[model samples]
Target: MSGKSSLKDDIYAAVLDDIIEGIYKQNEIITEKQLIAKYGVSKSPIRDALIELCKEGVLISHPRYGYEVVRINEREIRDVVDFRILIETGCFRVAAPTFTKEDIEELKNFTLNECWWNGKDELPALKHWENNMRFHLKLISYSGNDYCYRMVENSTGLLTRAYAQRFWDQRDNRAWNIDIEGHLCIIRCMEEGRFDLAEQELKKDIASFLDIICPNYARAVDL
Candidate 1:
């Protein structure tokens, strides 16, 4: 990427991050002129970033309103989570048998560090969310399925931001404050070569979040 393009990508990422972090709420209008002034960039980068956001379903453009943040729905949230569970659990189960002791230890360390950083007041929620995403993506990367890995990576950016924004908007709870003990449980099950239990735990973890975000679907899935 050229220097200008790289800067544009950075601008795009920063704007998306702010939107996903709920700094820009639903139906809020944003303009390229404002962004151009805020980021001290030209219209090219600002326009490109807005277009990218539009493509990701994060923003909508109208003739009268420039661009507005998209409102999330229960159906979209549930669908994303369900898709994540299917792809992630499948990846984990397939890769669990191949994980080395070193691999497991690394995962354990990452989880612990996340727990530690989560308790620190200086750590921003966005950083915690990013770390949480990295931890899961790293695990799935081990599956050796390049295509699946890329798909998850791409879908996760948009889905995670949407889920996180809605979650924080509805509740004051911190994302990092989640019960990561479930992660330890998953790691232990994988270490013991108990793939079935690991899969079950994974489903439970995903289901718990689904219940919070989309209770009706969670109940339906349980039934």
Candidate 2:
């Protein structure tokens, strides 16, 4: 990437992290100058990053107040998980029929390779999020439906927002342990050609996750 483009991406990640970490609350104003100083960069990259974030619905631009963080609501949180369930379960129904031992091995390797799912928060918060994304995206892709894959990618940001809020608010070992176990359970169900069982486990997993992340999700996303 060009230097300016790379800088823009860096600033974008940093700003997103700050917002996710509750460094800035919902509707909090963020100035270009503040970001420039914080990132030690020029206006061009900061502006680019903020504009992209605005487009992503993570932030909104205000003529009077620089930029404001998004306040995600309970409905939006439910919608993300509900939508994910719809897409993912459908994928599992189809994908499991063709699921192979090698596929299971590959996915197992992928999620467990750099993850801290054994005990607790041994994994960094961001790494845990990334690991979840990898598993979900791969699960959908195995269905051989490109559209399902893309839809999950597009809609997953809401969960990311919610997950980040919980992580920033509290890092619980139990949560991580359960999350990893849920993934493993689904994989095993798929391996056994028990697609129905896989779907049930997935629903249970999502419900458990939503319980911890929602209602309180606005605490991190809103003002």
Candidate 3:
């Protein structure tokens, strides 16, 4: 990449991290001057970063004004959660039939170790979240379906950013704690080759999460 393109990517990554870390709240106006000073870079990189964030649905741009953070919408959160359920459950269904004991142990160990970092008022929570996602990604990595895996991974960054914002505001621990148990349960079911049980637990897990993140959205599974 050219120097300009590299600079743009760096700026994009920094601004995106700030948004995900709650440095910028939803629907808040972001002035170019402020970003210019914060990043201490030329206007070119700042502009490129804002444009990319807009494409990611993390920012909204106006003709006369600069970009503003995207507002959190219950409907949008619901839609994303629904999509997650479809893709993630399908991944587990396909992978569980052949999942091995080693796979289960790896997932279990990753989650249990990561839980230690949670509940400590960490500023960015990205490390904890990344590790948590790794467990699920590993479970699906052997599904022999690259498209499904890639789609889920790509969608997760945006969805997780949205959820993290809400999670920080509400300070709800129930959903977070459930996430830990849910992963463990899924691993156990897969280890036992209980595909049906694994699918059932996966649905419930996503449903509980949807309720937390988008309470007004349609349920993922009929309760």
Candidate 3 wrongly placed segments (more than 4 Å): 114-128, 170-178, 216-223
Per-residue alpha-carbon lDDT of model 2 for 150-216, expressed as tens digits? 8889886767776665555544433543358788898788677777888999777666656666635
- Give the Å error, residue 5, model 1: 2.3
Better of 2 and 3 by TM-score: 3
Which of candidates 1 and 2 reaches a greater TM-score?
Answer: 1
Candidate 1 regions exceeding 4 Å error are 1-4, 114-128, 168-176, 220-223
Ranking by lDDT: 2, 1, 3
Clashes of 3: 0
- Supply candidate 1's per-residue lDDT for 203: 76
Model 2, 46: alpha-carbon shift in Å?
Answer: 2.2
RMSD of each: 3.0, 4.6, 3.4
**Residue-wise C-alpha lDDT for candidate 1, range 1-223, written one tens digit per residue:** 3577887899888888788777787788998888888988788888888888899788999866689988877777777778888999999888877889898888888777754454545666555446656767877888999998898788777666666666567554534434566777888987887879978897777666665556676677669
Which residue pairs show collisions in model 2?
26-222, 26-223
TM-score each candidate. Answer: 0.83, 0.80, 0.83
Per-candidate local distance difference test = 0.76, 0.76, 0.73
